[model samples]
Target: MTSGSDGRRPVLTGLGAVSCLGAGVGPYWNALLAGGAAPREVDLPHLNMRATRMYRVPGAAVPEHPRRHAGVPLGAVPRMAVAAALEALDDAGIAGPDRADVAVVMGSEMGNASVQEERRGAGGAGRPRWTPLAVAGAAVGTAIGSRRGNIGVGNACSAGGYALGIASDLIRSGEASVVLVGAADGVTRVGMGGFDRLGAADPQRCRPFARDRAGTMFGDGAAMVVLESTTHARRRGARAYAELAGVAWSCDARHPTAPDPDAAQLVRAMREALADAGLRPDQVGCVLPHATGTALNDAVESRALRQVFGPGTDRLPLFALKAMIGHTSAAAGIFACLTAALVVSRARIPANAPLEQDPDCAVWLPLEGPLRLERPAVLANTCAFGGNNSSFALTGPGGTT
Candidate 1:
């Protein structure tokens, strides 16, 4: 089933976030409007890379409970996921008993790799517990008392978008009334080392669509949103932030690490997602592009936007969220979605991070300040390695074609 003006449509009712800005949704939104936070030096064991800056989560922001899951030491990633999940459940009014049937879906490329990294740094002289990529979802499931299925997605950076799509399908197909969908990733030695080795780690900050953009910076955090069927939400009198109208996915098997320079698959994903939502290119008020400050990625996405939106693409407000929050990798898609939902609910669009606009990426970005959201519907795109791409559309409550 697809979203529409019907009872089966999926709508977002609650949001939770833990980012460099802080731990709550209020702080995260306020920071975005206040021009975002600056990157800081992060000292990791054996991290000997020229690019040492990242939007690291403050020590106080991580939760203290669930220190260990089944004898495996829970790292910052799982802890942050737990915190965000609890907050989202509370916001959605899903008490412990009510959440027994709620399903959970989380996306994370690295998962709790930090625990293993620490062990390796300590000479591997401890118990043989392993923290796999499913730890984040498992941690949340255990915390929320969710007896239903718990699925973990690892589609590289676009994992969060895929997870959201799966949750929406479950709700629409009558398999679950509500789904706790989220993504979480903590900066790991391997992730940092790999990027540094590939020369994709930006030395300064994340400046997407910038002329002098070097590469992308990594950020660590978790974001969660509670999605429920329109009928179930109305039955429970749960307030909705926005309707998740549509989602589409595609893959460009042509390249393993690089996006197809022609961007044919990316363009198709955008068009199909809009079509699924029954919206025209002109109806989308804003977009959150997967602009990761990479040279070719930014340029290719710019060309794709022009192809999908035509000449009017210049007028669309593109929220370069990664510029402010850094690329949260696998969690980025959900973070972008949560940001879009806030734009619809609050009727305001946060300003983009300042940058010397790149001519090749000729997309409009409002850097002056927050602007009134003239249109209610928004679109967000996410791409990952292996050429996996996903796009989703969202509209405000009571939105009509």
Candidate 2:
């Protein structure tokens, strides 16, 4: 990783999102401030399971953008991704000649499982179709007229954080002046069924850190951010939301479907990420935890926090986004990132509404209402199945530039 003295700092200029709360960043931020659960019963006939509730993006809320995959079979994941990418580009004011050198990076877990199921149900007879996993980057890049390059990340739930990290490296290395980073996942029969088989699906809404917490329920959504080198953004006079200070990745390799009980590797990831950003744990005013509402995940993450933040961990305001939007799977990390960026920029943490407190999960979570940030930096964490872990340090526009 390059140091801040290297003449480039990756900065976020634009954000886009499609989630259960609504489409666009404005609606998503508003819903977070409203502080209520938005999960509804899953109505897909093919996805019959014991856990029936999920947070889904309303059809009316999906943005209608010009399709780049016309006549090609596309899935909801890529569609949502393209919508988000377009919004990010527009928000960043990167258009016409400026987009020629931009890149697109996307991430997902089960790419287009729903589309695959649909094809299989149709007797598997069709023309050559583009898989959601294969065409996500291409579709978004083509839609935005970005011919520089396209990359896709499939690192489970941590894919979004990985995508952002890679995008920042590209900018820091002078490979691209602007990059669109994002992730998307659509709730599918195969995905829900797999979780049901594992008995990790929650029938009720996600309630992270709650004593009665069961497991995580899946949500369908996509989130994207426009990252550009500070020099490039300043040259264009673009407004910045936050600086993408640093990001680090790690894996525990403990279990195929469970996080390591010790959380040593997770702790290293967070500490290294803070070091990479040239910030201390005490400097991080807020944390966007990967609190999936599972009994083990919440407890393990709390332990990791205590290890990193020490005595200050008890008061380090943690925000649980999944409780409002449900777990967005691969897109969960970026959702947390976007929310944290907004929190730091706005200087206010959104309220967390866990049902009840769990004695084991003793992290500082503001359940009564929102809290003001005395510091400017925020840390976002993502821990995925198969032991993939990622951490990012972000600061407001006035942060480290």
Provide TM-scores for the models. 0.97, 0.95
Best model number under TM-score: 1
Span of ten consecutive residues with least summed lDDT in model 1: 1-10
Instruction: Encode model 2's per-residue lDDT on 1-401: one tens digit a residue.
Output: 23464457888898989889887998888888888457887766655678888898898866554333645556777788888887888999988878878988888888756666776655648743544455667778787888887988998889988988899889988898899999999878788888888888888888899998888988998899999988889889999989888899999977998899899989999998899888888899999999998889999999999999999998899998899898999899889888887987888998897567899998888977678887888999998888999999998763552
Which residue runs of candidate 1 sit more than 4 Å off their true CA positions?
1-5, 124-129
In the range 207-257, model 1's lDDT, one tens digit per residue, is: 999999998999999999999999989999999999888899999988878
Q: Model 2: residues >4 Å from true position, as ranges?
A: 63-71, 119-132, 398-401
The local distance difference test score of model 1 is 0.90
Q: lDDT for each of the candidates?
A: 0.90, 0.84
Q: Which candidate is the best by lDDT?
A: 1
Clashing pairs counted in every model: 0, 0
